[model samples]
Target: MPKPPRTRAAALTATALLLSALLAGCGDDGSGDEDLTAQELSWKDCPAPSQAQGGGGSPSPLPDDGTWQCATMKAPRDWDDPKGDTIGIELIRVKSSGDESRRIGSLIFNFGGPGGSGVTTLPAFGDGYEKLRTRYDLVSFDPRGVGRSEPVLCANDQRLDAYFQQDSTPDDGAERTELVDSTKEFNAACEKNSEEMLPHVSTTDAARDMDLMRQVLGDDKLHYFGISYGTELGGVYAHLFPGNVGRAVFDAVVDPTQNAEQGALGQARGFQRALDNFAADCTSKVEDCPIGDTAQDVKDRIAKLLKDLDSKPIEGIFPRQLTQSAATNGIAQALYSKEFWPYLTQGLEEAYDGTGRTLMLLSDSMNGRSENGEYSNIAAANISINCADDKPRYTPEYVERKLPEFRSASNVFGDFLAWSMLSCTDWAVAGAADHPDVGAAGSAPILVVGNTGDPATPYEGARRMVQALGKGVGVELTYRGQGHGAYDSKNKCVQDAVNGYLLDGKVPTAGTVCS
Candidate 1:
């Protein structure tokens, strides 16, 4: 048992503090969507069990029935409204089993979209999560106005298709205006059609709903897990219910205090770092690599392809041709996983021949566009919640100024990647009052996971978050992996570490590192 390197251990400890905090909203981003400061309604007992018809105020028992139930619980239309209007919550409850029978409580999982769906997760990606299912009920649902729960739909299919298919990067004034107009149009339509629900979709409000769910499920406290955007949602819950927090794990954490504008800029810088990693990894394989001898070469090749797509979108992909939108999306997608950079090389290779199916597939995944011409509207939700979640430091001209640096950093994906900031420029709601500092609260030890090379969420953000939260003394779990969420892995080490904590309330020792 040799001592860990002093400087290395110091850095590790600092990293831990930052990330544990990042996953929570310590800073003020007043977007009611993320107001961690607001005090929460106290946790109460669950409603009478599904089996209990009526009782003399006896708390209900858990539904032992094997089948998981998809049901709606009710919350307030507005947190401000103590009793005015009620909103129904859609939930999926997977019951626990066997020795794990006497489970602590329901484990609420949110899959990160301010627009993401929880219903579709387990059957698809929870392959690594079945064990947790055996101990506690694994449940998730479309958060208010998201997915199957009376979702927010803006346009009819065709126009919606156009919306998803629209170019993210605007080259000329007309293009930028179109992007702006399109965004405005979507916002207007969403407001006009989904007006009643827009304000209610804020994260704090949803955290409140989660407490209600905890009550209905009879959990005295919460045992929760959130990913990506889910981390924000989880932080909101923790902030609103610091007393009720228990064994919470925030994987692929999001920095709460940084408003949407900051988030986008950080994400842009992040993707560039991820791309650089991918390029280096790709070229190391030489023949298998798609980019050239250097990471810069790959970036240059990508830029040339995007510029070409902007002028002449390559046809032959699917319902729509390979537009700059597709190319931008494709490049961004590859930034998430080093595994995909090979495809990045192939995409570049094909586009260099004046075609781009390889790249379009990458774009399709990045945008969450399905084969049926359907999309998750994640990009839309990304804009909606992000813009609403926080106020941007509006220096409109700063966008133009940052162009060179962003491009040099990201090449093909810079503007489309960079312009994600623009969504906040015209935000309807300002951010939280102050991005509160997390980890200041002396609650249970929080677990912060960071992939050394995640593109969208980025490792630096995680480092900053853990550092902020840990203040140099917290549990920092390193996942030497790539992509947005690493827990999706079937890998034994990650599984063991996470499962041990959730099931046994164990927190890995400080400076614990995993590959």
Candidate 2:
């Protein structure tokens, strides 16, 4: 999840938010193109403000931002059978800030949630990327199963609201059974609602749509920036179309090689490390701390609080009660950036006071819940895409067996993460394609960034990506900061390195550490 610009600055002003050597034959040459029928995009003003900005049922317009124009691009539902059915991919493009004659090219962006909306995000934080926008027309799209595209809506608002609050940590056999049952119900709902679309909404499908965008835009090669889960999509694209890969940067990188279980294990440990860092920082200023004076004290108190909420929820300023799942999500959301740490402090303080408004809102933002109780299709889309890309869903018995390992990885958030991965156990996959090793061998040197303290996509994932991309194809840049994303934070070294790469095509030397 991305921190909106306002809160991002606040967190990073308090904190700070990498890469290595040039490999031979890694530079981009004027690329070749296979002649294909290219579609054209007709730009128009976005929909009304209420429909666009408000979490309404209809499609969102371009957030009333004057500079952005919205368009819908047509893509084959199943690439292998292109003529069978087609779907629309929502796109928002902000033209270059400089003169059109001087414009370099379009830079595509994806902001991480397998379900995250580039339509909403670009408007929320576009200005911060003045360097890129000034030179290239910044383009972002809602992939096949997200946002204003042909979305995947599982449950309605009321049902989803209740589901979001379900207890994440099951304490007994009955609780575990309930958890498994709930997972089945949710997956069944998604299948019933979006059976035709689920099979084609994986990262590979999205990458094909991205290539369509490139063809329409008349770009000879692809220039892209992807964060967190988006990096997974970009990596897939790079491997599929190495010759089309241009200046691509995968920040807060995800390792494409890991299966669902391995990915979850890494994330469990990563989040635990982040919580420890947050606890250590929080204890230093005990007066503002909500739990205790030391990291272990904070950990124990939080674990107890979650356990307490599983049985008895706290009614906060909102009409809904805060449950263990929502509270865990709330805490995890704030862990994305240090600037949000104070907000986490404030939220936990309120939760301790028996009012959970702040924490609830935090969780709501992470899930894209609106003030009026409307929901984005993100939750459904996130599960669908993850399940589709990483096949082999775990059975109840498998999950129970792995429970101990997960708890050992993260006593606080591990069980929740582990059980949640089982949502696709019963969901059908139509000819699901196996993910291959993605090195993009013939592509230009791709920038792979790692944040030493990032929780969601751990730092080691970046190293793994570098290795996957082979010796020369990957450039490693390290940020000694705390956050899920590195480029948009307050670190001048990181900002300079990224800006320099995007603007001048200057690749940082290997092992470049930005402190």
Candidate 3:
């Protein structure tokens, strides 16, 4: 559910445009391997993003007429063997606008997805961070096995279209077998296409790369901004290089304590809570709720629509039909942000009339499919990194057994998330651990922001992260709001707290609340 838990927190941002117009070798041993860190980056004007990075024109110039710079930094293919082959980590940045004398080194960002290409993302949302840019260069990069960083390719566009279309929530034995076979085939394709990369794309390896990136950037401490899954990455980085951390923020925080199953379960509940909130909001409006007479009625109609779509799909974008799985995906995507709620209302209204175009567009956004039908490696990288980081692998039977529990969590999302546990079935690489180790015992204070209505990472994760980051390290800030993250909501209160912490050295009082 929520596109595999650590799925792109920016999906709602992408979906809105569709509605309108659409490792290892590289760990901190304290020795700081001089060779890799010593190499200089050759920054130049950013070129158009590659297909793997979600193809688009080059980043537009900043308000001050400064262009976004792009570069590739070499990192170990495997952190366990730092001297072995190297892979390029694609990076993008815009230098500070404030006085050079007041500049505070580079402020790096990783905006979730684990698969998201920060090179493209940073510039797309660059204007929002202009204030921070006044004191620091806003920089972001594609981790190894993602985007232009020697990306982990699996099926091609046509194959992916078919792959995503297949039913993920199976009912009978025959359907279950088909789902398993399809999942295995997808995993096999990834291994065949990226055997070498599959083993090294774990979170730990990426953490090491960040440490190397900090050294190469000439920053004595790594100043960072992490959102959603990026928060997990930030935690791992802090754990690895406690002494090297500068000011860091973790928003829409992921619980470092949960294993894959627990994480999925948490998302099922979170999405369900968000759905309930959506229903209540719609019904409370002055005008009649277009979708239902009451909040419960709205949810019931959705459940009925899904059940009907399972057997008889509806006409979607020209050649495709909207199947139950795709509709569910689209709904999940819409639930990510409250701004997209109106779109969800309209999509549901249209779906009730036997048309499915809008919902399909949202599904396409979730899968990283563009208007041109080309796909970024988002889904591929998500599965690859998740399978490598998580140790447990589930069989169809296990999912079947867990269905009731999942269903009880959320009538709309339960079975879907329960079935997702099989994504790592027959994965080529052995997983690294049961759960990530994020105990940064001696690290500098890291601001952890959580939104109460966040469907993906959930708000409770903020508290878990605070505890896991160890006492005095994670300063918890709560935003009683909707959507996946707090900072991007542009709520002045949340932004003020975060900006105060990052722009200055003023960490908000621990347990600060922003509404």
Candidate 4:
């Protein structure tokens, strides 16, 4: 669901967006060697982007802009439309002030979330990317069904709001009925209203769009940086266009072959890993960690609190009533970054002693809840793109059978997180059966990053992606930290390695673990 720049639900609507981690791993007391496994994951195909500028849906070129310009590139809403009756893709190009003289054409970035919007992303990251900006023009554009572009709309604001607020997790049998029914409703609505766009918003389609963006930019190659789901997009691009591969950095990559089910399972494991880390941090600073000496004790207390909240809503900030599921997510979200550790420890200590406000604030921000009660649009996009792209892993029977496993998977979030999956079940289209295993793409050299304890896009994902990209180099930056997408943090070593690749063609050697 990644938009080139603007977030769909992944980061856009807020709920679906993967929150950015602000710090790195410094301490680990929990049990679960949460760091990425260093085993060399043997990869398969790594294709280069095809630069054969001849047949098959010729891209409509847009005029080059020193600053900002919008041009149309030809694509297919159906892909069977090669006769010039093409889908008009809108492009926005912004130049860096540092690289006018030695500027290469462009370096595109996908922030993930199948629904992520690049158009909406430029304003935030455009400036910080000064290093790469000077080397190449920073290009951002909305993917087909995202911001500024032909957005794929399902239920409008009010309906979506209702759907999101519904309790995703249901403890009792009756509650499960409500969840199933609600999910069915959302799915039906999407099917009825979003018939036109669902089939088109896929990783494959998005990759092709990037190729067109490259062609229109007049560059012979495709240089890209993507996070989370964005990594999925970049990986697919490399598969589809191995010949035109340029400098690439796939930060926090997603293995294209794994479907949402397996991906969700990995995420389930990640949260457990993070929770174990949190417990360790809490226990070490007795004063900071109020939950006894044992990690299991801490988990029990939090679970108990969530259970209490489920029966009776708390009277706190906006929305007035915080759900137990949301509360648990706040904890998981907090674990994504090391900067939040102090506050997270504080929230835990207080919660163990009967206070949950601090943690509530963390959850509120993660879901994009404004001081006023408005949820971000990212939730919508996240549901749409993911649901559409991957087929459902659980059926009524499968979900019922797996309930205990998922419950053990997230504790306070097990139920709600389980329910958050209904969107794909009801989405208008059933996209790829699974992310295409493109190991045979024969793509160019790529750099894959994995943080040891990244709860969001787990380190395993990076390891798997590296194995998936047979020819790419894997740079394992040992964070001894807790967070996702480590490049954004102030880690000089990792930053230097990343910049060297983007600005200069310096790819780190295999097993190049950074501190």
Candidate 5:
């Protein structure tokens, strides 16, 4: 799965609404796009989110009764042929609250996933960014091939439920064949449903779109905030339009140097490290840890539970059962943030007693499945964007060979993530590159924040991003803390540095450390 944004409240609320119910961009610049750049967006009252964007009511008023606005900007569907066809890029924003004279330009955000709906997410967590909104219009969008932005579609929800329920960690040849076949079927569905889009959803295309967005928004420079996969998107934007970058910050940074295989391996290690942290935190609490006696014991018990679920699934939300795959996904989702640790503990405790609602809900959140059985297009977009960006495609045999290495990196997530490498097998469009190029030599200083306990992107990625971005272009900040990103962690130190840089043009010192 792609690294989801750290929207803990939204994820949890989705589950509650579902048990009662259910739950659940690019770039830059310039030449041959004069009409697009000059087009004025028809911003209006926001409508309720579409199913592709994850079904939800329209955004509520801001804390000060400021309404969120929505707009769709037209962009060439194919950057190679700028005038050939057009697609809508869904956008949402709230104007700056402070005096207009004091306001900076728009502060656009990309909350990662490479597949996430920034249109929906911005409002879900708009309050967290209230301070930044004081001086800049907080803007985000559903990049092309995502949400209402000419979304990519795959299998129906019913098929997806079965698809996700399949035994991901095969024990034999037959099971391996089944896994491969299922992946091919999923990819085929994507091609059948979105053939035109498959070829144009590359990160490079999105980067160009962002540049167009910059022009349409009337910003001379792109002031930005990116998290997780968004960081990678931001890096690509900077690389493509170095001179257009203004104040930018990349949190939970993705390593721009690693190829697909290396990236997966890094995540395996990152997630395992987070699991260790979760276990340690659980055991060291003053209250008795209900799940285990020691840190290792906690992990051991989880392994046993998964082992048992492989053969005999547990009761999940009525009619569905929690299989090993679902349990593993749930655990990984919880490991995304320290605030979610308690939910993991509770889910584990409940699973031990044969109930799997909590874990299943977590897995549902991960997969973009809602209580009503409808799904957001996140999974489809994630696969499409990843397959389009990552050049390498893995076969079962290659995955089998790499299993031991993956297992060594993470016994719990090893086989699972290893198998995930086959997501692009038989994909329709050939990928763009081995990995992303984020070398922005002339770009403004971009703050790179890495959390020590981030499971998805990993802490090491921050330094790797800094190095890959070229010296003096990427300034590194270490948050010796937990979660997928730092600023949202409500860490005063991390936020202070980011706020200083973005709001006042005061860049934090290179190699700054915040606890």
Candidate 6:
């Protein structure tokens, strides 16, 4: 199965390097000549999954499971002209199962991956939050160029598989040539197949779509819950439609203040912190401790292992060997959620046993690759959205110059995170929006959640997000724990406070902590 739908968006920061490129698009002010209409969502029974006949994987009738009703609402392909071509906004809804009189309203969700399917993510939340279901209708949609929507398909499975295994940390001129060639090849595939859609699949466009969804759902104001990259979407929506914002929750907040480079570097440091947390926890235990007694010792062992993989890839069940990129991806993916720590330990143990099959599977799952070689549009769409949102150019010279700083930020994962920005460096089209200040100054009280040990979004971003949202309008809720997000984690205090705010508009005081 794919990694939990709460998968993170790529970390592309606005760097000083981008100072030279002129930012093209501006935020949508929701003021236009054409009027928007609320089309009724024609709901229907969701389709069941088509079972696999052979070893091939089962085809999912996603955005819909039998428990919910599904609809495809029409949205403008280009929001600039409301009269322009239309695209389907795939949606799914689960009505309140509680007292009808107590219904709060429809709660819209965006579960982070600029590519993550709300259709897939909402079910996970729905299964856990019974109270949320009773009080409000839960709704989620596949954003433009994502999932069931007009997805951005760049390379096919074979090409992407090769791209994933290519060495990211180039030690020599030949290695750098391979890395650059693979990146350019992937970009060419995207340009070939999705050039038209690639230019428009940005956070600004997605935020406008959210307003249209609000109108169709008959909600006077948006009741939103955005996690991880979803927080960026939520912040964007608030910026564009502050008047329509109501009871919005941004968990695992992205730092709007940071540019693409800062964002990337922040994430690198965040992952390193999470790795340290994992090390600290593992070493404290008598069993399943793959590293040493001290955190630095654990780091040393991991560094040695990654170095070994660089020269000699361990054989795995997958078509490709366990390359360093895949190994790092697997380790980073496991760090997103604490529940996967044991699997990380297991994978590392098996790697020490000379086979990297387990870690390869973890990496594959995180990348949305099925066992039968069927790949989802998550990776493709993620690249397109991020590139469209923040297209910062990077050269071999720039990467080389900044490599030391990146390594300083994160001795283990820094190089990979910094190089992650390379795919967009030569984007076919410029980024749609510069991601202007999203303070959303006049929006209704917005609750921002942050985890102290979050490996992806980082706590500092959440703190900064609150500051950007302005005083009184934004409230900060801190989860003093290790994870990418705070809500739905083990902390009941954070859960109760968020649930109360979403359901009853009760904002927790600033600096609220859930230990």
Runs with alpha carbons beyond 4 Å of true place in candidate 5: 1-34
Question: Number of clashing pairs, model 2?
Answer: 10
**How does model 4 fare in lDDT?**
0.59
lDDT of 6: 0.75
Candidate 6 lDDT trough over 10 residues, lowest sum: 11-20
List lDDT for all candidates, in order: 0.59, 0.74, 0.87, 0.59, 0.87, 0.75
Evaluated at residue 239, the lDDT of candidate 3 is 92
lDDT per residue as tens, model 4, 411-453: 6545554555454654556666666655625566788877776
Candidate achieving higher lDDT, 3 or 6: 3
Looking at candidate 4, the ten consecutive residues that score lowest on lDDT are 46-55
- Give the per-residue lDDT digits (tens) of candidate 3, residues 382-421: 8898889999988788888899999999999988898889
RMSD of each: 10.9, 7.9, 3.6, 12.1, 2.9, 7.6
lDDT by residue (tens digit), candidate 5, 398-420: 99999999999999998888888
* Poorly placed runs, candidate 3 (over 4 Å): 5-9, 22-34
**What tens-digit string does per-residue lDDT give for candidate 2 at 1-515?**
11111122222221221000000001111222323346677887655322122242322222223277788777777788776556777788877877777677999998877777776566556777777876788888778877777788788788888788776567888887887788788888888988878888988899998998998988898899888887778888988998999898988888667777777777888878988998899898737566776888888888888888988999953678998888888788778887678777777777888988777777776666666677667678788887787667677788788989989999887887788667677777742544435777888989898999988888998988888877788899999989787988758998888888888899998789998
Tens digit of per-residue lDDT, candidate 6, span 415-459? 887777676767797875445467787899999999998988889
Candidate 4 matches the true fold with a TM-score of 0.80
User: Ten consecutive residues with minimal summed lDDT in candidate 2?
Assistant: 17-26
Clashes of each: 33, 10, 7, 55, 18, 6
TM-score of 2: 0.89
| lDDT, residue 412, model 5 | 93
Candidate 4 segments exceeding 4 Å error: 1-75, 84-92, 99-101, 285-287, 290-297, 342-365, 372-375, 408-416, 419-421, 471-480
RMSD of 6: 7.6
Q: Which candidate's TM-score is highest?
A: 3
Off by over 4 Å in 2: 1-36, 48-66, 286-290, 430-436
